[model samples]
Target: MPRTLRASDTVISGNPSPACTEPVDGEQAEQPVLGGAPSSASLDTLIQHLVPTADYYPENAYIFTFLLSSRLFIEPRELLARVCQLCIEQQQLDEPGLDKVRVRKFGPKLLQLLAEWTETFPRDLQEESTIWLLKDVVGSLARCEEAYCLRLHQVLQALHQKLAALGPGPESLLGADRPISYRTQPQASIHRELLCICSDPYRLAQQLTHMELVWLRHIGPEEFVQAFVNKDPLASTKPCFDEKTKNLEAYMRWFNRLCFLVATEVCMLSKKKRRAQVIEFFIEVARECFNIGNFNSLMAIVSSMNMRPVSRLKKTWAKVKTAKLFILEHQMDPTGNFCNYRTALRGAAHRSLTAHSTEKIVIPFFSLLIKDIYFLHEGCANRLPNGHVNFEKFLELVKQVGEFITWKQVECPFEQDPSITHYLCTAPVFSEDGLYLASYESESPENHTEKQRWKSLRSSILGKT
Candidate 1:
């Protein structure tokens, strides 16, 4: 890639200094477009236009993560996209093998902020927003000191309680002219419809490919704390922290989306009989994924089933056939440190070795491996007591990261049909409010008080019902 972002000069003065980007004056720069994250040229312009004397290691990006998490922005999603893109660009420029993380320094600071947020229970932000910010902080701090593990667990427990109170959110489900009754539909018809809407494995692989490139990336030396910071001219190949944080954010979002779709689809059935059909539909979805050798979606689908909202539906689960569900869950078993998933992944890798180039398979497990590497990162130091590179520990982590990259080279030969993409993406997404409503309605259909019943009946007539 052509050089675009300027390198920040490191003086090793042991004092904070200002950082700036050298302007890239090029003919390719053009007016910003109407949509999407900031244009590349616009990003360049914005960076250069900043005040000249700002502090180098400022907490702007870290602070932005909190604000972004709160979703108070006019366009929260777009804002996040813009910032992440900027960070990715800077990350690419920091290459040359420093192998250090730029933002890991913010982990402890972010944790402090989260602790305060939890304690004070900031009233200005909605509970849902605080919950999401807590998740973001937790994701970023996975590689924090081992001693903080208990603290982190406590934080999660508190967040979970807060979420139960918050419900899904204030927004209700959107109106559909004709709410399809999955219960009334025959299993075969439902299966046929699902077959039509099934995601193209190739397109799914492409998404994984995009994530793997950015997520599995290594960072540089300047990104690390002073203890691990080596100044040897040849000692500059450490990994950056941005890649891990971004990857974690992306991975969790992706998995949660799949989970959301699964839970929402089942909950939205509105009829008790069809709930079983939803479970069966997903079971087949997982089965077909296995047949196609797409481990990524299989993990996602299975994980979705295991979420509390879905698991709490004991009546629904009792109606589901356990054979396929058991096998699939066993396949992804996290026991003994995911021995089964690792074995399955390796077998899938070996099987795809000789498959026709046009029919090649891609297996990407987003959650497990990333979490494993995070454990590795936290378990050992990258440098020894004398500040020498602990290549042994480093190499082990590198081996795991390298597998995602290497396996990614496998070709996703099938061209994605745009129609298939649209069909699969058409599933209605639920917010916090929707999930809570669905869970309550499913769990307690007849438990409403007489007055509550009349109100619900009235609301139902208006579609809010």
Candidate 2:
């Protein structure tokens, strides 16, 4: 390996620096065309640019962009190892006289590059191999120059603490620590009991906001970074991938549970008036969630109320008022690509930005946000025709995901109601089939279509029993 790189050598960074001319592992690196446009560069070119030269450092934007997109093809540990190898080879530590001079020139910039990587995506260092490689690199630097020892160790320590904090806590692993009460209550008695306890719609909304904020707060950029990665065939047997995306999965499950809970509450009631009352209660809860900028919960409640079983209860709906529910549905309508919902989200976000109180916070429907990001990622090319990274695309991704980072930081203004939260978390909800069966029982099949459907449901339920 030569100490000085030639200008014609391939480079991913916009600033052309000397690079190794030989194709890494017999793979031909993509060469830049005469025009400024980048052609598709080899993965090795991208990795080489990550190693900072004594006089030059990779731009911050480029560093963030590469680290994010690189993970799609290669694991973080391997990438880190390659970077360490390049840094060492560049130094050419075999010669006694030049060692001190090269280390002195290159050491701080190397530390800076590593610091940027660790700070931006600490989760990447979760693997033991990556951590060991990082320590080795830092140790080598510490040995070369005593001045870097303190800062290098500090970065390492902070990373360990961060990884520790990111580990799942007891509360996350197990639902509410205390045992759920009212487990013994019969199905018939439980519906009425639940109504009496959770009668206050405003209070219910408050408790829901509390839970929503808790989940949102813990979700880091790493989750979104890995959102588009293809699932491994063995992900089910291996817990690693699940742990990486658990906060996202848990939030989604919360949405589903709330939807089923709303449906179960309505269908379980024997009397039309009681069922109508439950419907009205949930409508008000949805309204309150909207007022609190809790669109996620609002959509869950609205979706449940609109479920087939719940919607088929013509008699129950006739008795209930739906003026407020209609407005909520309109705002959440998926028409025109959810233009109404997007407008509402923008307003809430603006209010949050300008408001004096945390109550003005906005939490967008997270699943939709993830969908938007996935499309953004897929829509753009990773490399330009001239062989440079598509840095512009990454900037757009950062802007979108950056807003979420801001939104999650808002403190929930509502006071927690322990009993309401407990009930929300622990109350047993009926499955979809159960909800349909209960719906038919609440109101007998209106005609033959209903009669046949009801019959099939009965047979299925009985057979399962």
Candidate 3:
């Protein structure tokens, strides 16, 4: 401790002063940034260490591995295989969270794998796994736009190839060996879910329209038309009617779903011009149904179709009802009243007279106002032959009966017309604070004086004196 030396000799001899012996700054040393490329040895070490752990890893860990592997571009295929396995497991477990995370992490890669598998595999394997995988990828992509478009394009391309191979037949694309788990209800559910997620009515409408086109082409026009017609001879039977009713009900239900998608979910994608086109198509279909006398079908079509300026619905309904009435009238007899004719005339007289003859004679004179001499027989008595019958009373009775029968015969057709109900049932009435009041313009002094005079006269007439 007491040793001392000269500075140059002490430095040379490795005996330095304490102040010069301070350590270099660690902060000044170079450091690698996070998320940057690691050295090859480090990556190798990571893969070796992760392999065993990844085997026992839970679903979230697998997803994390997949995402990390994608960005790192190391062992992507191995990670993707593990992810696919996890996805299959998640589906079996029915764990929505795990399934969603797997889909979100690896949907694009899975789609790529599915496309490659479909191309590489045999026809049978392609039909079994590839098609199903494609469908699942599409379903998953509903949550991610980029993925959805990529998968959708892939599916469309695959579908085109499948369609080509199968040719123009129902069994071609679907195939006999492959099981199609996609039923109407599930398809509808998927469509609804997609609509909810996208909330883009135009996109939904476009998707549905494309689906409709594809399905229609596959089914063909003849089969589609047959589906709409009343086919069952046993339709009167409860079971048959029930089945048909159920089919129509399903169509109606799905139609309502489409309506909501177009109206609410697709608001962002909608354009006035495009909406007008849709409306125009609906009107064209409605007109076609009307021309074909398919009123019930027309009503169903109209009910399920969407239009803007909702008031137009009232006008459309009015047209449909009017058309139905016209058709009904055409189908029935043209005489003034079918019921009255059937009730008043005997069988022989009914058979003897034509509808036109009945209209001219019996209907005009007995059911309508007799405005001309043509309504009466040229030489017949004006009064009944019996003396007990008073002529004036007979004419009055005939007039009253004629009016009643005519009113009963020709139904007003419209249910809520004021003139049809003599303005009674539909007229509006107003009351004020538990009292009745009459509506009037402001009264003049002379009118007020006249009202007072009438009140005085009424009081005098009822006086005790």
Candidate 4:
């Protein structure tokens, strides 16, 4: 750890000039130690660059630690111990229960290097601080008899002994409790916010579209498929599953769930008039989504209404006008792999080229974009049999991805509307997806006869009374 003067280029904390000595021979023998190895200062600088700074979110800290672990040349113990300790300590400051998930995000690679590759750890590996790092990994990996379990078991025992020697075990804290004041009490008054916002479908659509954009902004385009694909396509093009890819999948599920829930609420309403009103409201919402180029929510709204639970509500349908609804449905028809949607999206994109302040493409329907990405994934090989890259195929995918990226660049026209935000965020309790689909499947004669039998029985009883 101490800096010694081997050559002139000894890097210190502050700027220091290299020592200059007069040459003895005809030519200087001290020809600047020609590239033998990087100095300690250079290695430290590399680590500094690779490691995440203090401002990094706790969730990403493990990844920084993961990269640090891959450096086999370094003194892996002291540095790695500090990283683990800081991650656990920082995560505990916010949500203590989330520490396990946070640490596990670094993956099994962290443990593999520490247990198998670390030849000579620092003398302080027996220290309680260092042992706790091993224990955290043990808890995260749930390793009972894996390759690293023997070493980890000994480390855990040492840590426990050190803790016992210090004092009694600390008292456990009580679990978090939800308070009564959090719930809103019911009242017989008009919801002025909803009444005002419901009439302006454009405003409502913009708000919903904005929410989608907010979620989308968190995901980088590269990060979406980066984790799903290989580092070098020519080496091996097998799909690799990872944490970020899981996040992308979950994001799609949320969109689908949100769509279905809204329609379920509309269908499950008790009053036919209010229910009819909500249907018309959602219909206008669909139209607004189409107009604003937010086809994601547009598709969501149309599909939600088409869900049989909403569709079989014949009474509600009878009162509703289906002109706009029919138009939207025809556009989303899946017969040609939803090519109709592809054309509509292209047209909407063309209209958006003018870049007016009044209109913005808040959220482009990335469903088609994702579909294109899937085709790109499966349609062509990344490399040809001759070992050259399939550049044509690769470029085609890149072009599609480029268009997808460019589509999101349209200037947003509207500011946040709190009235619409409140409406979209809050929703009534709804049954599961399976329950709704089951309701739809039971609409045949056997179920209809059962329903009619119960109705006639009720009628007979009322007549007798």
**What is the per-residue lDDT of model 3 for residues 1-465, given as tens digits with 9 covering 90 to 100?**
001111111111233322122224322211211122121123333333232221133233222222322222323344434444454554432334444554555555545544543432213232444445445535645554455666657655875686465344322222122121222132232233232233333332233332222222332111111222334544431112222133323333333333332222112112334333434444444344333222223333333332232212332333332343333323222243333323333332343244332221121111112111112211222222321111222132233333323322322212232231221111121111000001010111135654564344334433312
Best TM-score goes to which candidate? 2
Would you list the clashing residue pairs of candidate 4?
none
- Backbone clashes in candidate 1 total 28
| Tens digits of lDDT, candidate 4, 1-465 | 001111112122222112212223333222212122111123343333333323332223222222322232333455666555544454342343444444444334344444432322222254566666666755544532244455566544554554344232111111112111100111111122243455777778877776666555434344334434554447454344454344345456556655655665564445667768878888898898888778888877886776655666666677888888888887776645566776887787677677575354645555556655654555554433433233334334445655654555444566877656655554332344322332332332237754564344334432311
Q: Write the per-residue lDDT of candidate 1 for residues 1-465, one digit (tens) a residue.
A: 001111121112232211111123323333232121112233234332221111133233322223322221123334333433444344332344422354344344444544444432322233455445445434443443443455656765765565455343211111232323222222322343333454444344443333323332321111112212233546543322343133334444555565666766666655566777777777777776765566767777776676555665667777777688788787777666666767877777777777775335656566565555544544564433433223334335445645554565555545555554443344445553455456556666444563375345436432554
Superposition TM-score, candidate 4 onto the true structure: 0.51
Q: For residues 170-189, what per-residue lDDT tens digits would candidate 2 score against the true structure?
A: 23533433321211122643
TM-score of the candidate numbered 2?
Answer: 0.78
> Which of candidates 1 and 2 is the stronger one according to lDDT?
2
> TM-score for all predictions?
0.47, 0.78, 0.17, 0.51
> What are the lDDT scores of the predictions, listed in order?
0.46, 0.70, 0.30, 0.49
Q: For model 1, what is the alpha-carbon lDDT of residue 334?
A: 62
Higher-TM-score candidate among 1 and 4?
A: 4
Off by over 4 Å in 4: 1-199, 230-241, 358-362, 426-429, 433-465
What's the candidate order when arranged by decreasing lDDT?
2, 4, 1, 3
TM-score of 1: 0.47
